[model samples]
Target: MKVPAPNDDRKGGRVPRWLRILLPAVLIVVWLALAGVGGPYFGRVSEVSSNDQASYLPASADATQVANLQAKFSGSDAVPAIVVYERSSGLTKDDLAAITDDTKDIADLPGVHGDVSPPIASKDGKAAEVFVPFADDSDLDTNVAGLRDHLSTSTPDGVTSYVTGPAGFTADLVAAFGGIDGILLAVALAAVFLILVVVYRSPLLPILVLATSMFGLCVALLVVWWLAKWGAVQLNGQVQGILFILVIGAATDYSLLYVSRYREALRDEQSRWRATWIAIRGAFGPIVASAGTVIVGLLCLLFSDLNSNKALGPVASIGIVFAFLAAMTLLPSLLLAFGRAAFWPVRPKFGSEHPQVVGPHAKGLWARVAGWIRRAPRIIWVVCTIALLLGATGVLQLKADGVPQSDLILGHSDARDGQQVLADHFPGGSGSPALVVGPASELQPMADVLLNHDGVSSVAVVAKDSPSGTAPVTADGVQPVGAPGSPPPEPTTVDGDVMLQATLSDPADSDAAEATVRSLRTDLYKVDDGILVGGVTAVAIDSNDASIHDRNTIIPIVLVVILLILMLLLRAILAPVILVLSVVVSFAASLGVSAYVFDHVFGFPGADPAVPLYGFVFLVALGIDYNIFLMTRVREETQLHGTRQGILRGLAVTGGVITSAGLVLASTFAALGVIPILFLAQIAFIVAFGVLVDTLIVRSLLVPALSYDIGRAIWWPSKLWRTDAAILASDSDPERLVEEQIDAIGAGGRPSHHHEHLHQGDREHPAP
Candidate 1:
């Protein structure tokens, strides 16, 4: 249960201290190096997405197939920007004049190409769109940001211009993230202060939690950054927000354990250092087990079919691991140096038995709930089952989709305006779907064929060229274009293939896009040799296509993981079985409720692509964590007392802490909903709902009753546990055994030796 101590050869905690500083320094140096070597920063930014599975298509072909394909897209690589003009006050002659001037101005901006539409007024003359083509397709996000900034500055009264397309979506995400950096820091500080004030009853302690968690977050972020730079793993912008939450919440959980126990040791008559060490030993096992459950749950994300989902799981797991480490080591070190004043003003007496979870009269609310369960356990089960099943109806209606970039921004955002422009004039698929790369020879005919297809709104063809002919000159400037349509020419390719560019009416990330893509996927290869489709849409479809397989694999995989962990810890097969089953029920309830809220009430554009998988992994896994906390207490108590009494005792002891943790976690996710972004908000709602289900229904009520009903069969055939000789004398006092932390500030150092001695006495015989 204890952390492995540092060796005598290294003392004064210098090793860990140096590690904390040196690690980040090494990572930053490496990141700058990679950034320097990765060609233009645009190419480097693009490289971040190059390996993402969701950013790619299904691997039905090799490099040769892809090479054979991209040769066709010569003319269309420079996707046009939709220049939107809106006059909510109604477009006047001046509006048109301003729009014309803006379009002319953009024609001269860096990277602009092709013919732009004049400001065509809406039926009500409130809107118009102009088209500006990009001179080159590289560094799309940066280019868009520049364009937006310029246009925003130059826009005149009674008119506005929105530059939107695939490029525009990327631009908006980058812009929204501008504010996110500060918000994340604020969120971390707020969560820590809140936790400290509630649990420790002091401002100083919460500040410590924040500082400790920030240290853990810094390590986690540094690692993620290193991995991102080194091509080890990738993180999306969405990942950044969730990562902040995970690191803070998880690290705070550990901080709570360490500080609370540290205070208990101080009250037990132990010196600061000794009490800190004992607290580590006492708390280490439970925290590790708790964190293990979370880690295992997050690791289940590896089984998720989506790259974003996969990336998120490991990122969260890594944060939790680092937090766990800080809890065991760094936190103990600081608390050892802190002492009795860590809990000031309202100290619970040590060496004196406080009230147990079940009071003498058994008058508390928890006892009453236990009595109801014991009186009609089966009926309670049925009622819970019915309620859960009803909640699960929402899950059955679960809907999911890939979201557009504009979906995240707040109102009146230029990015959203751009998206609206693109949506109105161009097909949504002009931006994100995977491309079907063919040859220049294939492109002209393919565009012709694609333009005629059902989902297709337009097509542009390109061919390969090599010092082929005089480049066509335009007002935009003469740069490069593949030869006119003989298998869209590539700098390097044979005569058989060309690129076909097609745009769809559906949003690049929507189900409609997926459906049309499904149709295209079937017809694409049939046309000729060296034909392929690849793009963001292509990848999203692949992700959606893989959902069935992914879920199939994940269900059994998660079940097995849970079963094994529970069996090892409980030494009983049946207990783990029920535990897993109960968790499954809670998970179903989470999904059902989310489905109703997401699909019916709020009518979200779509559930996050990774929601189902995350829900399963988090709910089932964390659900078991509560089961472990409650059941372990119950089992320990049951060994001495009867089953019903043990149930009441265990519930009384662990319920409050479990509820608090759940509330924190749920609140964190709920906070995501407040973010204007549709995808993040939906993800937040579902996760919060899942956590609530796990903590309230599954953990507090169902687990204890189920344990009682199962009887000795719960630990069947495990004679080792049945023997009183094997286990410690049961004492059901999780709260009293560890001190309830009360922090006070502005003292020279720790509490006096007399109080320290009393705290030490509490540690030796923890029941008091």
Candidate 2:
């Protein structure tokens, strides 16, 4: 335990002082330039992003196929905006006149596609509706806002108006995600800054850490934005928000590990140059291993059938890669530039006695906890396991099958309110309709089949010559709304197929409507196997199914992939398996608790099937990070001090930094709740809670206790186990040997000469 002298250079070739200073300066300038360039892309992300659910489905999905074919028949993809005008009493003549005039005026607005449908009054005479179509390529939010503005100013007295349908919902969704670029980032950064300030009690260190995180995010966004603009990847608000949080959280966590190593190194090596190298060498293994685990785990999403899920894999992986680079390159340069001043007011003095080696009386909180674990390791792990299991039982109550599209946005929604109004007075699916595509020759048969279903209120076929762009199709055949003697309009056809629109008796996003679409597809296929049923409801069904498919398929793959990674990093089978199991249990418990809270406390209708999938990915991948940090150090210590003493020393030393990292990660994820989207909010709660559980309970108590109880076998089938066993066997009394080692460490002296078998290099420069 003889401490190295300050600024000592005798053990290696000396680096030129000028080069040392120049190197850090160059790196800092390079990062600053990169950050400056990437900064503006944050506001430009929406330019290349899309939130359309139908567009994210796989090409092989029925909904995707029907959507593509329907576009062919219409010659344009138009999103329908249903305008509903209602009076509690009855619609007056003035109301009808004003609605008709409003329809005409709306037709002239920019992006309005085709002809607007004439106003149709309901049988109750209390409500009327108009169908306005917007070209898909246009700015839906801008056009929808204009339409709403026009209605707000021109609506008849006492007649309330609402714009709701695919277009309206799209607009609202866009507005909800609008906060991602500004408010969300602000909240996440503020939370992280506060936490860093509290943890470090040093302003300079927090600023350096925040710079590393921000620079990483800026560069990552730059790459992702161009990829999206070039059509190489799809970007959406959800993916964008996740990328920001992931890069910031992962980068900060990595920075914390480096800072910890640097502080520890400075105590042993006074020269900033030598200290920087020592810190980098010590932190490099765990940081790279941690980032690799998360990146590889995220890439597993490529196996997901859902396009949105697949897009997340590479997008998040890019963020992780940049986070790794910023931590390894940018952060080191910043720290090296300032040296001990980076941690001003709490600078680690050279040759200072290390805390962990200072015996029981001088032990900090983590050391005290480690002592308690050593006394009753089995009981602690068993009790913690039972508590986690009990919490996980709530998973049965989780309603992750799917939620109504109307419920996707949290809080007030004009579109949701309008949908209720439309359902109360008119055919629930007046504006949104299930589309049926089949052979042109079987158009009548298809119409008849649709008409047979109780859920179908009416059916229509695309008609090029019709004023409304579609003519009503009944059991009798296509009906002529023109002059009595005029012939019915010809149905538009594409690739030997005809398209039929079936309006349902329930809202398009309703569970009833989903069932109706499912049955319609089943019944229609009986008549013609080539027939396909799709619409808003069908899109939800397919998206949910694909998400569920991804959850089942990708979860196991992530576990297997992460396990193999752990095995490689730890070089032990049993230890890796134990770590994976601990993380999985932690995920289950987090999801279980979140499910109960979402149902009872928040009154959440339900979750997207992908919610669990995302929670699992983030919690397991990110959650395992603390364990990796702890175990790698434990393994390094075990190589010198024997398993039991090494486990204690590792826990005591790593406890503070690992806990700080967990808090930083959890808080960054919690910031996702700022966006008023249900999926993101649910993800925020689940991941934030899971990281805490893993950090406080699993990593702190469960993993360490289990490893301690298992002893050398935790490294079973590895050379370390045999080497440790031999070290233990050579000592007649293991307990006395551990005490003697602790006393030697406390006195700043080497262990007894009898224990000279330990590696000299490791003795000189221990792993962080």
Candidate 3:
């Protein structure tokens, strides 16, 4: 199949030599300035990013309510770090003495709150647990490190110590995300560069592509940082990491499309200026359509109930915007400056035969695929659909309800280790408790309900007059720790409200604790509708529930939105429906594969509910990108060639470039695995694998075959249906006739290019 010629009129007429040179120079300088200004914000993202779980909860969530009231109860926001000292042989007198000394030292550390609870020895006599409240404003990682250093230096010789709890976990999480700036970016860029070098087989071309992508990311970061700083959006490590990879991957993908068009154009036009303009016009529609689909789908996250998911929508959309801008402007300018040399050793010469020639028929790999489709379009789509349906059965195995907070981070976690020790000795939820806030007059009633649950180990109400700031509440009433008949201190009250803390029998992050918190809320809400139950367990429950809500709400919205976008872009209802179905099937298959791998191979406890939501948004939005690329070209080709011939021509022309773009995107997302976060790793694998599926099977085989079997009806309700322009354009050329015969034989002995009668409208004027 021969590529269509570039008309000077279609590209806004010929560009003058001086303007071409001057335009590229201005673009280069502007992009370099953007990169220079935004580069320094890389390592400093943490200044605006947060990892706090409660901070991401929905405003209406019980945990969010309790967290907001925490200052009223405690006078300051504090994160508790539980320090556990253990000995296999059981605790000795010296060990007990050393534990006391360690507590005092811990209290003296910077960022450590003044109220350090005395070390409480476990009944088993093998372990001691101490609660150290760290001010929320402190540098968590630094404080945790300092505490660890102090304990290691001052603890008894035979005893071991670990820093764990909300604070410890938060510190570990912060440290994990710390890799995003340096290691994650390095790996993603390195992978993209290497892939580009191999794909294009040119060093200079890869460098140029990398520069465009990096510039996009740098400028995107600059804009997003100020937005985050100004409170227009929330920034978190997960969102930040995703933004980086998305920009680089997306920018490169768009660049690949433009570069493919440029190289193809270079062969047809002698002047680089004309070639660049033609390439830009040809590449513009598909690139913009592709980016628009992704951006709209991501924006659907705004409907999500969870703050984290909501925040990600605009954050990622901003990245995609920059990616689109860079590809359309920066990449085109750079390519124009270098012209044919951009491809270097494999540069295309003007008027050279299309480089991928195979025999006199021009039957390349994609041509072969088209021929295979033509032979049995029905059977090809049927078999592929059946296989995909079978693979989708594994979705039943997907455990996306939630995973424990401790498991959120992949490798070793001192907090996780300490939780186990704490559970083996003291109440699992000692330092972190399920807090209940209600009217001050009803504090005892709430405390009694908590005490009634088997999961509740103890209950305490905040008492301002007590030395420990809290007094125990038993079944009878508030119990004084002082002499008998002495008056029990009044429970602390703020705005006629009081807080009650219930220590649990299970670890704060465990499922049992979450269940307990749920049950407590159910019981307490019956007593008083305004009562709030929250803390570590409540945060987990609320976060998981919100994620589930988001998955249900946002997934459907994203699909509907993308479906509409596809319909508008393709200008056909039936085609958009089919494309949406194909992508949905592809997404299900990807999730199914992930489910089996996570359950059997990785032995992951489960997945975050948001995982499927994120996977759906990315896969369907991104997976449909290849279809957009293919079908738009197919539609364009159909306008010139007949529908049947256009399907083949479009598939043949687009196959290599689309596949390269998919592989590039897949590799970039796969780079997310290097961060060692379970959420990122799952997303990395799902998106990477799904993109390849879209490229290799869905876009290449199923969509094409289905469209071919359906014929011009694929453009239903559009004027292109029932029209054939191939004869009017090339019927007089003898070489075209010979090529048609060759293509017919290549396509399963099908009859060569038979023109159809034009549709009812404009039979006198053939399609241009």
Candidate 4:
């Protein structure tokens, strides 16, 4: 092995020395500036985000139409907060008086809309409830906080008070999401950093890799924040958190591939400039294909009817784009600046021996695994496929219809507790009611219909002059609230339409309430097809329906898009089809396993419908990446070594880097659990587990062994398949065939024969 002179610049050719120095320096400075500008936007994401479930419903959804019509009848956009005051022994006179005073005090608050409802005592006499409406334009969380604080200090002795309803739930969701900027990012970055440190075992290299990820996130956030600010897209804590993780994980993964290539190039090329160029050229294709697949898969979300799902597409795609740019540009520049020092004690010296290429005798874990595959390719694939199928059977246990709103937050929740207390004392849907909008002429008929339903505890029609802003409606008609013989309050009418509010017999977030809403919509539409039903329960129903629709619609599109990309990438239809099928099976196994874990292991009540869709998008798109990484290298190796030997070499060489990359990505996604939101937590587990499955099993064994077993036909309809077959036929001896293939590809040196005896040993005990 010959070492080159330290000042060797022959490989740099006629390129100016100053120009090389200036290029990397400029890239570093530019990235630093962009990162500085975008860093602070992390803390400001909540400004443009809304957690209101109604806001995410598709515009064409029945709930959305009803929500739009609600403002016309009320003349104000307000979200209701239900305050429950409970005493196990029963509320005394003093407690009732105190509640009356609390309502008056709440009305004086800054964001209070119109009027606050006086405390209404339950028949059980154990609890009293007050409905407070907060103006939508005002700071809702702040107003809810003030109301809670006032009640906390002023509630009568021995009475428990809690603020829970749409507004309270919204406040809880906001608080849960508050960690996205600080804790979530810190946990994810810390996890990735620890993983990188262990993988590289170098101090400076981990820092460099993290710098690439951080800079990419900062720039991605800068662009996303502006897009959200301009109202071109919607942002939520969920989307924001995902963007941070995606950019960091993807940028780092891409960086790792580049680093591997750079180190390999450094061993062969003495000039640092030449090595950097070589590394970029080698890394550019797979990284772009990986990023493009993810971007297109994410973009497929645009077809989703749910706004949250739709918004995630472009927002996450933007993050991937920047991750690609940073990995391709900034990471390379930084690596160029550091050169051999980046790897520190383990730096690759020029002219050093490379890992033994494609042989049973190679001395590494992956090499050993490769040797095993060479011995029994068909058996390995058959057993792996059977095991994956067995694991996939657990998908039947998955309960992804949707979870109650109270279950959205994983831990303790004031809103959830209050909803229970409210349910025990009075109608379950006290504060949150199913809102119905219909023609004013059909008001009496609608009230009759509402009164006929078993699920409806009570019904009311909005009236401007009514003390509670809504008058109770009975089978007869709208009734007055003040005194007997008093005139009935006129129903508020907007463009000849009237809004009715029906309190359900069950909790607004309960599955029973959703069922009731569905039934009521069907029954109500029979009386008047123009009637629209919308509220908390309706919103949940619509969101779940859209998610299921998106899951069914987008999954196939993603498959087609990724399949085409793979075909173009591998230049072989059969190989891409096989790769896609392997990942699809892996995703199913992951979900099936996740379903069992979510049910029996963790005792999660149920999942949101979008959970599977999100899991598929990430697992399939990102999962396919490992296949791309493996198959592309196999294709490159095959051009020189024929199909059977190429699979072995590609697997051995890529095994370490791809596994490390998978760990990095899985760890980042797992960090989503820190947010205390059930949806993110579920997503975190599904993706994390799915990636490991893809890396360790599918990519490592199934795809490789299956392709190896098929031999050259995996590249059918391509010239390499025919060319490699001819080379294999020309010589019966494996060592001679390898030398002939090298000559066929126009290489300069005779192939290494140190492993010639190893090939002879394999030939003696040929693979079954």
Report the Cα RMSD per candidate. 10.0, 3.1, 4.8, 4.6
Best by TM-score: 2
Query: Candidates' lDDT values, in order?
Result: 0.60, 0.88, 0.85, 0.88
> Given candidate 2, what's the lDDT at residue 38?
97
TM-score of each: 0.76, 0.95, 0.93, 0.94
- Residues 401-441 of candidate 3: C-alpha lDDT, one tens digit per residue: 88888898899988888888988889888878999999988
> Candidate 4: which pairs clash?
none
Off by over 4 Å in 2: 1-7, 10-14, 728-768
lDDT of 2 by residue, 654-698 (tens): 888999999999999999999999999999999999999999999
Candidate 1 C-alpha lDDT tens digits along 8-39: 22333444656644544454344334434421
Tens-place lDDT digits, model 4, residues 1-768 = 667566466667678989999999999999999999999987777777777776468768989988888888888888888899999999999999988977788899878887788899999999998888898752787888888888888998899999999889998888898898889889998999999899898999999999999999999999998998899988887888899899999999999999999988888778889989988998899999999999999999999999999999999999999999999999999989999999997898987767664542367788888878877989999999999998899898899999999999989889999999999989988888999999998998888888899999999999998877889999878888788989999889988989999999999999789989999999889889989999889999998999899999999999999999999999888999999999999999999999999988889999989999999999999999999988988888676556877788788888989999999999999999899999999999999999999999999999999998888889988888779866444213353455565675476664445335445433432221
The per-residue C-alpha lDDT of model 3 at residue 280 equals 90
In candidate 3, how many Å is residue 254 off? 0.3
